[model samples]
Target: MGAKAYFAVAAAAISLSIVAATPAIAAPRAAENYVAMGDSYDSGVGTRTYDSSSGDCRRSPVAYAPLWAKANSPASFTFIACSGARTPDVQKQADQLTSSVSLISLSVGGNDVGFASVLTSCQLGSDQSCFDKVAEAVNQARTTLPAKLDATYSKIKSKAPSAKVVVFNYPRLFDLGTCGLGGLSKAKRERLNQAADTLSGIISGRVSAAGFRFADLRDRFNGHGICSSAEWLNGLSWPINESYHPNTNGHSQGYLAAFKAAIG
Candidate 1:
């Protein structure tokens, strides 16, 4: 072949090789039929942006579930989670699920063990009272919470058998650092964090046993707990209902990031 022809052939071959080396872009996936269910955490109580139509359910646009839906533009999004929801209440919420639900995210069991009450006691009562309250809550988490969670998970599975269920557990409320006066002491904070760990462990076990995905938030929220320099959780806010829950940043950065990772 002539030198020019030979050069042209080599260039063509190189072009072909480059094309072969490049990966094909995957087609975008179909929109999901998502259902958000559980308790205040799932409903975005701490964000303080609620849908009045939801009434006491307190579903918030800033919560992780809605945030995901808003960003992804899922085929359909249903928000049924309510404030103060226990495991049984979550089970009831699952009743709204159908076979069409392609995705589900849940955060529960905190209320089942009376965590709010425990936190209140820790805040308002004596040191011993705080210890006692945490211990009692931990006991319930280990003993009673497992079965209840199992039941709720089973119900979710039964309702939306094809859905990809992701169970999100709570974050450690405190960073075990010294805040000013009227703050929980390091000892009390340690016990509370331990209780959170116990609860996360129990929920993880149950989620695994039920063949669902478990999205642990403890690591994600590690440096952003209440006492941290950058806090993602509320600390005894004006509306007491917002206390001890993830703030807007927590929902967007912590919980939403974990949910996306879990689904991906």
Candidate 2:
């Protein structure tokens, strides 16, 4: 071929190479910006894949927020929920929220009226002391917890005005009988279960009043509590703090199902 013809061919090849090398611009995502906020139940405290990189938050990738985001492919997911968070702690988590956020899933209030302390006292103390501690917690749940929940929920709404907030409650811990694995006596279990019911009722009432969806897991965990043959919640662990939290099955089956349904 002549020099001029060869040069023209080279130019054409170069143009084709350039075109092939250029990357295609991806289509924008049509998913919401989802933020998960609240306490240990929302943070996956007892899950195997706990992310220490998130510090004391103990955020597991298997946690419902991350699981839901993975399944649905949200535009973005921010998990600000921490372990041992009370209603006040949730206020800090809500700081991560913005007007652009489209979905919020959280589980708070378990720590607000000292639910853990009550459980600990009941699990370790004498029957009389256990009942007394529970009574105190019940009283606080009736009187103090409502105002705290209202303030936190209101703040969350204000921060993420357009977001659909779904607040999840803790599961009932017992089946009214001892499985003989944990230390909780039958009578103690009844009192603790009543406390759980009280807490759930308080949260449900406030969540409904705030126009937020309440994801009730009590019924779902009926046959899967700590005393069940197939337990979904951890019994007394050596660390003690890890006990009473949801196990892997609880997150995958209990919380995930309720969460997906609530969001839908």
Candidate number with greatest TM-score: 1
* 11-86 per-residue lDDT for model 1 (tens digits): 9999999999999964243468989998999999999899999999899999999898888888898889999999
lDDT of 2 by residue, 88-165 (tens): 889987888899998899988878788888888988899899999999988998999999999999999999999989
RMSD of 1: 3.3
State each model's C-alpha RMSD to the native. 3.3, 10.4
lDDT of each: 0.91, 0.87
Number of the top-ranking candidate, with lDDT as the measure: 1
User: What is the C-alpha RMSD, rounded to one decimal, of candidate 2?
Assistant: 10.4
Reference-based TM-score of each model: 0.90, 0.86
| True-structure lDDT of candidate 2 | 0.87
lDDT accuracy of residue 17 in candidate 1: 100
